[model samples]
Target: MKLHYEVDGEEFAAAGQASGNIKKMLKQLGIASDVIRKISIAVYEAEINMVIHADGGTVDVDIQTDKIYIALKDTGPGIPNIDLAMREGYSTASDEVRDLGFGAGMGLPNIQKNSDFLKITSAVGVGTTVEIEVNL
Candidate 1:
């Protein structure tokens, strides 16, 4: 099965909508609780990142018998340095974003921790794409 969602940028209140829906679907499909938990956390973090950083973005999820694949793409300012961004406390979120109690720089790290495989690609002046895979 394949699922797609469009994340609205700067919409903090709506940040987890996609992840919530995914979680519900996973539960209905009888996915393991632990697997559902991991996917929910990873997707929520990615979704929050889109709302907080990117102007907006798209999330695509593909579910198969052996694995689940998730891809998040945004046209916002790309990460200048993937290595730096991967640091636990490194964040470029604006003060306004911080005021909302989000953006602690743990998004990517959490995503990495939850996924079996992860890949991120970005261009300085263009955008970013994050691909995550979780083995079943």
Candidate 2:
């Protein structure tokens, strides 16, 4: 099955809607609870990043019999250093965003930890695309 979600950058309150929806769908589909939990957390963090950093983005999810694939694409100021961005506690979120308790820089690391395969591509002036997969 394939699912696609559009994430709005202006709505912090609704940032995790897509992830929540996916979680529910996964439950209805009889996916393992642990796997669903991990996917939700990872996707939630990515959604927040898109909202806070990028203006907005889209996520595509493909569910296979043995694995799940997720792709998050954003047309925002891309990461200049993937290595630094992967580190926990490293954030470029603005003060306003930080005041909301959103950006602690755990997004990428958590995504990496949860996924069996992860790939990130970013161009400083262009955008970023993150591809992650978790095997069942």
Candidate 3:
């Protein structure tokens, strides 16, 4: 099965909508609770990153018997340094974002921790794409 979601960058209230929906779908599909939890955490982190930094983005999910694949693409200001950005406490979120109780710099780390496979590609002036996979 495949699922797609469009995230609205300006809508903080809707930040987790995609992940939540996916979680529900996984539950209905009888996916194991631990697997669902991992996917949910990883997707939610990526979703929140898009909303907070990328202005907006698209999330595509592909579910198979062996694993689940997720791609998050955004046309926002790309990460300048992937290595730095992946650090547990490195974040470029604006003050306004931090004030909202989000953007503690743990998004990418959490995503990596939850995902079985992860890849991120980005351009300085263009955009970013994050690919994640979790074994079922």
1-136: candidate 3 lDDT, tens digit per residue: 9999999998889889989998998888899999998999999989989988888799999988889899999998899999999999898888988998878999999999999999999998799999999999
| Leading candidate by TM-score | 3
Better of 2 and 3 by lDDT: 3
What TM-score would each prediction reach against the true structure? 0.95, 0.95, 0.96
Model 1 agreement with the true structure over 30-90: per-residue lDDT tens digits: 8888999999999889888878888779999998888889899999889989999999988
| Runs in model 3 lying further than 4 Å from the true structure | none
**TM-score of model 1 (CA atoms):** 0.95
How well does candidate 2 match the true structure in TM-score terms?
0.95
Return the candidate ranking by lDDT, descending.
3, 1, 2
Alpha-carbon local distance difference test for all models: 0.89, 0.88, 0.92
Top lDDT model:
3
Give stretches of model 1 more than 4 Å off. none
